[model samples]
Target: MYAYTALGGPEVETFLDLPIPEPGPGQVLIRVRAAGVNPVDWKKRTGYRPAGAPVPEVPAVFGGEAAGVVERVGEGVTDLAPGDEVFGQTVTGGYAEYALLPAALTARRPPVVSFEDAATLPIAAATAHDALVQLDLPPGSTLLIIGAGGGVGVAAAQIARRHDLTVIGTASPAKKDFVESLEVVPVEYGEGVADRVRAAAPQGIDAILDLVGGDELETLAALLADRTKLVSAADRATVARLGGAPVERARTRAVLEQVAAWVADGLLNPRVVEVFTLAEARQALRRVEDGHARGKVVITVPA
Candidate 1:
């Protein structure tokens, strides 16, 4: 099997003859049809890994989300089996011909959903749903999302609108028309952003989900009537100091299923704007790393 992997310390290259990893207990090996590319993949490759992420062996496979047909199931995984079409976060790397996904985190894909779209749900869409659930804002309340042009931000805006919560989002001028199409009041980040948000939402912001952190997180924190309502996905320490917490993730199989159902029902769009082949996985990673994708990027594996 062939896969794209991140070598030690900022090195990413393709491995054309990697051996397939077997499914372990609570895991399933899938013949990947599509994999989602995210900023985290590049971050991890460059040593900005998430807290407690295991230091895998050199040449570790790349990607975290994928959708495909199950080739085998591990112990205690009874809900899914060989030939079941599923999508979820990868326990093994997703940017490959075959990879492992935790059965508990994986969900059966509805026939109506495409593999490309399903591959994006585990991280971006799931985070959006979990953040909204954590906020627990009532319908009609105005919600604000920082860094709204990106994948997770876009999902959150659409989901919020569907739930009847008005959204005001911070975005780049390049994404102006796109963000507005979601019915979110788009405030361009930097230079009087707070004032722009204020102008967009005269009713005031009820809650905020911050995807861009650091000084921006601090800037957004002041606008909230209740500081505790702010959730930061990027800077946990900054959020804590402002009397808020990090975005709480459900990280459950149920969340994946809900996101998939939303896609099937036309309530959400994964907005996978760029599709790359497995051979072009490096370009996919580059697109996400460049931070200009403005939508989800995915790599497809041919059977």
Candidate 2:
């Protein structure tokens, strides 16, 4: 087996001849066909996340989202058998050609969707759904999504539109047309962002989903009509201190299952902007670290 491993700052290497890991109790072995690369992968590679949690162990596999066919089922796992096509977030080991995931977290992939598309949905789509559904906003309510051109942002925009909300998305000038094509009002993300948003919705925004954390967040805070309407996934502590709500990512099979169904029905979509082979995982991380990808980046592993 070949797996991409992160060795300290700015270093990722492909290790060949790594032994395939066996599934433990309540886990299943998946032969990964496609893995999704996210901003967090780069952050981890660069040591952005605080140390102390696991994954610092050398030769650590670094992907969180993946879709593939099940190769073997562990003890007590009866619902899924060998050869089941599944998708889920692996706590570790997604970058490998074969990885282990707890049976509870894996869901059967929709028959109509490809592994590459299914690979992109677990983390980004689940986070978007959690943010929108947690708020319980009524149809016709105004929803604002900051950083709308990124992977999570694009998914958030589509979900907001499906719920019948007046969706507003903020992005760079280059992404304006793409965001607007999703039926989201596109505004530039920098100086005067709030002013532009106000111009689009004079009555004020009913809900805000902040994906970017920085000066833009402070700007977003000022535009909210009420503090409760502000929700964020990136910076929880900052959002809480500013009297806004932090949207937590839920690791549940049910959420992934629902998103898969929506994708099958054409109500939801995961925009994949780039694809790379497993050997090119380091370059893929560099692209994500550059912070300009329009959507998710996927890595295909040889079957």
Candidate 3:
């Protein structure tokens, strides 16, 4: 199997040949067809380990979600069998041609969903759904989505529209048009952003879903009268201090299936904006790391 792996920390990713890993009990081995590229992929490559997460062994593969046909099923896994077309959160890494997925988290891919589209749902789309569900905002209320040009932002904006909420989004100037197409009032993020949002929504924002962290999270927090409605997928501590909560993800197969259903019904768009081959994984990571991609980036592994 070929994968883009790191030796230790955030360094140059190199394509290497590695032995295929066998699935453990309750796991399944997938012949990866496509893998989604996310901010966490680059963050992990650049030495951003999640809190209390163990250090990955040397030459660790990069990626968290993928879609492909099942090559084999681990012991006690009866829901899926060999040759099942599946997609979901991966066990270790999804960048390789063959990756392991815990059977519990994986779901059967719908025949209508493309491999590239299904690949984008497990992490970004699922998180968006979870955040919206957490907010539980009523229809016709205003919901603000920070980092609205990225994958999660796009998904959240679309889903928020389905809920009949007025949507405002923050993004770099580059994504202005993309944000507008989602029917979200686009606000440029930077100095004086709070005033911009206020001007955009004179009635005021009812809730916030933040994907970017730092002082900006604090800035957005002030827009709402009830700070309890604030949620951040980045910077948990800062959000907590401001009376906001971190996005609580369901991370279940059911969540993935729901996201797919939304897509199939034309209510959600993953908006996969870029696709790269396994050998071009570094370039794929670069697009996401620089924060320029308008939507999701994916890597396609040849059969």
Candidate number achieving the greatest lDDT relative to the actual structure:
3
Model 2 earns a TM-score of 0.93
Q: Pick the candidate with the highest TM-score.
A: 3
Q: lDDT-based ranking, best first?
A: 3, 1, 2
Which candidate would rank higher by TM-score, 1 or 3? Answer: 3
Mind giving the per-residue lDDT tens digits that candidate 3 earns over 1-303? 333355334455777778888999999999999999999876776567766777666577788999999999889999999999999998768988999999988998989899999999999999999999999999999999989999999999999999999999999998999999999999999999999999999998899999998988888888788977999887788988999999998989999999999888888889998999988887888888888899999999998
Q: Rank the candidates by TM-score, best first.
A: 3, 1, 2
Residues 34-83, model 2: lDDT tens digits: 99888876666655563245646656677888999999888999999999
Question: Model 2, residue 195: displacement in angstroms?
Answer: 1.6
**TM-score-best of 1 and 2:** 1
After superposing candidate 3, which stretches have Cα over 4 Å from the reference?
A: 1-10
Where does model 2 exceed 4 Å of error?
1-8, 12-17, 50-55
| Steric collisions counted per model | 0, 0, 1
TM values, all candidates = 0.95, 0.93, 0.96
Q: By summed lDDT, which 10 consecutive residues of candidate 1 come out lowest?
A: 1-10
